[model samples]
Target: MTKLTGRLDDDRRTLVLTRQFDVPAEQLWTDFTDPDRLERWFGAWTGDPASGQVMLTMNAEAESVPAVPCRILHCDRPRRLSVTVTDSFGTWQLAIGFDEDEGSTRLTLRHEEVDLQTVPEVGPGWEWYLDRLTAAVAGEAPPTLEDFVDTYAPMGQDYAVMISGS
Candidate 1:
């Protein structure tokens, strides 16, 4: 996976991460959009996720957003999926994609349009979550973001503050 700190869609403020996955497109898509499939490897969703469905309050624990609610923007089986969210940081797109690769599929997922200035919490976050994703798909243990905010977010804040100070 190639992770770069830069703009997406030519927007200088947006950050894009392009990554490749080794699984078939269908499997990856199911794992991404299906709440049940996600719960199998990730956290337990308080409810199911379907296109146009309004997320329930219980889903706050496991959902498209951990810190806040978000809307499911697009879901195209085995190819593309995206979500739209607005936080204290800013508005942005989170997306997943898959392509045919010698019978398997090449996957690229991104957390795009993030405000690096406001949401300083997302830099090390992508690296940390992507690492968990690799482990999750491989049937291994992955740490929960909710479980690690105290551990990683503070460190992230300090690191960003340091970078900005310099």
Candidate 2:
């Protein structure tokens, strides 16, 4: 696995993050694209990326995770999905690709458009969220953002520091 690293440029205020997860790409795609499967890992899911609708709530069995209205900017199955999230001043693209490794899938994610405004929370918060995602794909329930909000706040700044090539 590689330490996730990327940068923002003068032309773009986006922070592109990539991470490799030991999971199958298709399975990763399912968890990310399919609402039913997504809820198993995501605290809340609303709609289907495959269907071009937002899956903001996870399972009907789970409490509704609020949905931020987003437009599907790109939906390349088993590869990429770009969505514009509300409360977020940027368009985020989530890309899932694979490299075969020792009989497991190395799932890489690229989250684009994380500018000055988005960088703070997305960095450190991503640590917990990505951890939850890894677990979700591994068939476990993910901890809610509510469970780690306070902890992530200060730490996220530190996270950006580390990510900024320090």
What are the lDDT figures for the candidates, one per model? 0.57, 0.57
Candidate 2: deviation at residue 151, Å?
A: 5.1
Q: Could you tell me the lDDT of residue 83 within candidate 2?
A: 62
For candidate 2, lDDT tens digit of each residue in 1-166? 2133444544455554455666656767777766666656554555455566563542322344455665677766666656655533444555445554654666555565455656666665565566667666666766565555645556666556744657
Off by over 4 Å in 1: 1-10, 40-51, 56-68, 86-91, 144-166
Residue lDDT tens for model 1, 19-54: 456777887777766666665544333433564533
> Clash totals for all models, in order?
0, 11
Against the true structure, candidate 1 reaches a TM-score of 0.64
State how far residue 148 of model 1 sits from its true place (Å).
5.8
Model 1, 71: alpha-carbon shift in Å?
A: 1.6
TM-score against truth, every candidate = 0.64, 0.66
